[model samples]
Target: MEAKNPLILTVRLDERSQRFFNEMRIKYFPPERNLLDAHLTLFHQLPDTNETLEIVQNSKRGVFEMGVIKLINLGAGVAYKVDSQELESLRQDLKRAFADRLIPQDKHGFRAHITIQNKTTPEQARLLIAELSESFEPFTIIANGLDLWEYLGGPWKHRGYQSFNYLDK
Candidate 1:
């Protein structure tokens, strides 16, 4: 079988969101060798070839300014607090765009959470969540860019990401 052309997706992130993730990294997430940009992915697992090109070409253009909010506790090793309306709209638009090629299905029913770190032991996860909850307040962020990227591998291995497009608002 032909090697999958690195699972590609498009996304955007705001400054505050990025900072939050960075703080989480400094506090708990292990330093990664090849850390890519922080973004809220809009699409994933897109098939390859001309169809991918067309999809990218026809991708909708818009600006999303999402405010910072607590990412309340997400069960099963996830937590966050937010009721971001703009983020929700962007997500919906993405789902509509890639309805044919990629299916938007999350094992946990799409809980909006910025993944601080994956592959954590239950104890570590709990402790991290508690500490974050204690220190977490609320903030706001203005996102003015959209980007296209391809995942290099699951989440390990060097050269974890490759940027394809960076669209400004």
Candidate 2:
């Protein structure tokens, strides 16, 4: 990978929940353009450096349950809103560490979500949202760890995973 490529950090969901979301994403997202399975990104871009990897690996967040609380309309897509105060705290910790290097979007507030459909027409998105809402019920998913990825241009390559160790595994 190029040294200049950015890194992306995401919360790794449990296997069961991840499979469920991946299915939804595949069913709703445009197949031809979908680049990744469903995921909740914590940081969109971080300098590809050892310091970035070290900071993430040293995170102290424990495994926690995150609520897949709400279904949201992304105007041109659909997503599931996830919530966890613990997750927010983790983001704050990393945000402070990368204070000077943060991009505009990462500098602002962070909202956790996993998009199921995107890059589609608003009308198509609305229809999917309506269909999903009819059967949607809030659920909780386990956040097992952090996933560090090397962003090569627009594609991502998984680098490593740092599992949360607060609870016995």
Candidate 3:
């Protein structure tokens, strides 16, 4: 069997959204296990090839609106849910472009989200969800670019980012 590649592709969030989500993670996520900042993953794993890079470079970046806040039960953990049609469209386009090389997880429909806490007790997850829900509100964030990373076991190594054209109004 061919070995799986550990490259991950994600959508880059605007500064404000990034900071906000990072703060949430810092507060809720276990410090010892939290190895990454807030992120919206597009593809969990893609084959390490020139074609993958080309696909990212050719992809266009657009603004995405954040939908309602909901709690996601991750078995023993939890996450904040996010919905974006623009992000879904971009993901579909890339899915088609890399259909032959995408991993099983990436081949499925994309559900954009940023995990705030994971790998904790179910009770803890429920408590955090309840706490966050009390002050939840919908918001919007700009999709600035596509980021590629080499998944180094737990810690990810930054590879590069392809920024999209932003038209100022």
lDDT of 3 by residue, 1-169 (tens): 7764578998888898889889988998899999999888988888778888898888865555656357677766767677777777888899999999888888876777888888889999888877877887766677788899989889998887988675455
Error of 1 at 132 (Å): 1.7
lDDT of 2: 0.90
- Per-residue error for 160 in candidate 2, Å, reads 1.5
What is each predicted model's overall lDDT from 0 to 1?
0.53, 0.90, 0.81
**Clashing residue pairs, backbone N/CA/C < 3 A, model 1:** 68-140, 70-81, 71-80, 71-81, 72-80, 72-81, 74-79
Point to the candidate with the largest TM-score. 2
Query: Candidate 3 — worst ten consecutive residues by lDDT sum?
Result: 60-69
Of the candidates shown, which would achieve the greatest lDDT relative to the real structure? 2
lDDT tens per residue, model 1, 3-103: 75544554445556777666764555545532643445545566555656555555554555555576543333444444567656655665666667665
For model 2, what is the error of residue 46's alpha carbon versus the real structure, in angstroms, after optimal superposition?
0.1
Query: What is candidate 1's CA lDDT for residue 52?
Result: 60
List pairs with backbone clashes in candidate 3. Answer: none
lDDT of 2 by residue, 18-69 (tens): 9999999999999987889799998998998889989988886678998989
The runs of at least 3 residues in candidate 1 whose Cα sits more than 4 Å from the true structure, single-residue gaps closed, are 32-37, 53-62, 72-82, 104-109, 155-169
Indicate the TM-score of model 2. Answer: 0.95
Which residues of candidate 3, in runs, are more than 4 Å off? 1-5, 166-169
